[model samples]
Target: MIWSVISLLMPFNLEVMVNQGYLAERSGYWGFLLQHPLNSLFEGGLVHLWFLPALMIAVAIMALLIRQQKTHWMLPIAIGLYLYGEFAGSSAVVTGMSAPIYTRNGPFFSTLFVVVGYLIRERHILWQSRSALLLAMLGMAFHFVEAYGLHQYGQVFNTNDYLFGTTLWAIGLFLFLLAKPDLGRKPWGFSLSQSILGFYVSHLLVVIMMMNLARFLGLAGLEKDTLVLFGTLLTTYLLVKGLERTPLKHLLFR
Candidate 1:
């Protein structure tokens, strides 16, 4: 939930859509349900990205209510909701801004994340080294190929989509490491709350600052987006580290 909030606050699609006032006016009951500035961009002006969060919430509630009724419907309803959002016209176009290459595929990919996470939790088959390595390699290879396509052909893909899959692998590794008696059961230790929060909230700001600095230094044409991205990430890491060492960590992270 906190990550969701951070995703919302990040200087991404939501901010732009709101500024354009595109989300305030949408079509259908689903649009109404997702009628936030952000929703306008996700729903493709009718309700794209905005609908996903609502669907997630609605599915969760409905799943609980219908737990005794029937469970098969839960997966179907969730899948349907995600597909409706991704394959739909407007939102598909809108997703390109952040995850350009995978906009059309976002629903499929995002739905996979949710389903996989649920299965992992439900089955308690948290981690196995071979499975983790296989999944991570497959995901990374696909992302690398897609990224290359985007770079060479001017296609767009979502970096976050790749990140999501990789994060899953990280969590799996963490789980595996935690299960080892020598590593200690410390899944929540080391406190990623501050660093993750700082990165999600201020990483874009760091990017903007880096770009402007590069431009002001008359290195505009020479500056690469990858460098800016790396620099921003590094700055974020340092900033988060500093924050964690400060008393204000609680105010920011907690």
Candidate 2:
């Protein structure tokens, strides 16, 4: 749950991931929250407001009430609203109701994926069939096509993210479908959480250093954008290596 909340808050201001084009739009939400933690409790301007955190708080309260009453369905509904509401609304709201499929918000809808992951842990479902594997492969094909399309289209990328979303949903939903069998393995191959830490902290370090370098270089136009990307990855590797030996290791992995 702590990780879930942290993941939920990640996109609101991930200056690092935004450059990587992960959840750029959702940065507005996280940014607003970070800038005005109090105002975020209420509302804001025409852009991002407090509705999301409000909803989260509301869900928390409802969950408490349900817990007091010992209800089960509320858990699913609470989790579902947190998941689906964010899933459906993030892409919709971010792109002004145009692209309804991209997972460019936060980990809201991804929360469902995590839950399915938990189910995999409990039920041992992925080994039952190869359908999920086939779906994942197909979805990857489409995801690549859509990403390539975005790269080709360039500035018009926002208008075409729906294709990206469709592909992601195909892959994501298929993954969920196969969750029952594939996710609950006893001896996992690698540590996803560790990888996330390395990626997250390293990425943030890169973004910060790149931003500072860009300001110093005064590199305007396409050169600036290109440099930022290059600098981010370079710094990421350097920071990842440096952090491995620091006391902050727990901050990344824990």
Candidate 3:
């Protein structure tokens, strides 16, 4: 959240779409706020960077509901919101037009997924890793099927992010990870994971630079993609590692 504020003030040179925001939303700091004064409440502070704020909202609501012992209402409400999101997103495919609203934000997705996690935890749910993996694969297959169907409808946009298949996919993969909690307990894993926050917030800077350099050098195909991907990861990881040793560590998490 704090880092994004920097981009709003300075000419961060980010293409407006970097946030997956409408072009009209681009403006100087004050103008940006004036354009969508309640943006953080709706699409988040920025659309592409919506996860943290969404997660925060979900957690806050869950905390309140859980304390009141009235969390059972969440599942039904979540279903309603999820259906609305799916309807809005999928209607675009059928109508050959943009959806009337973006429903991938806090109320639609974050609240639902967070409630699911809470229920799983509170109920002490468990699953076999093999079965979880099979479920994951099945969910992925369903997602592809849905995507292909939408493509046949002549929709040029990307896959819908909040389909039923996607929910199943998340549940299965999450259970799989929970079943193997020790997977990332190794020294190397600890070292690599320590700078996750730093990498996430700063990697795009290194990535866009590498992307342009790759294009300028006439790099193409998988080679160019591999270079851009790994180059950004290594560069950002090193920068984060260095920053971890400095005063900026106060601003960013370990």
Best candidate, TM-score: 3
Which segments of candidate 1 are over 4 A away from where they belong?
Answer: 1-72, 89-112, 126-128, 135-194, 221-230, 244-251
Q: Candidate 3 residues 1-254, lDDT tens each?
A: 56557434433334453555544334554475566555545553344556767778778877887789888878887778777767667646665443334567656678788888888898999899998888889998887777788778875537467677888888899899989998679998888777777777677667766886786678999999999999998888888899899997888653
What is the Cα-based TM-score of model 3?
A: 0.80
Cα RMSD to the true fold for all candidates: 9.2, 9.9, 5.0
Best by lDDT: 3
Candidate 2 Cα outliers beyond 4 Å, as residue runs: 1-75, 82-110, 127-130, 137-195, 251-253
lDDT of 1 by residue, 1-254 (tens): 44334333333333344556544322233334354434334333221233355446554545574677765565676556444544342233434423322333324335545554565666776556666666656656654664565445443555333333344454455455534535533555446543565665556556656775565555654365656877887887888788778996777666
Is candidate 1 or 3 superior in TM-score?
3
Q: What is the number of residue pairs that collide in model 2? A: 8
C-alpha RMSD between model 2 and the true structure? 9.9
Worst 10 residues of 1 by lDDT: 42-51
| lDDT, ranked from best to worst | 3, 1, 2
TM-score (all chains, Cα) for each model? 0.49, 0.47, 0.80
Clashing residue pairs in candidate 3 are none
lDDT of 2 by residue, 155-193 (tens): 243443234334345545555556554454544424333
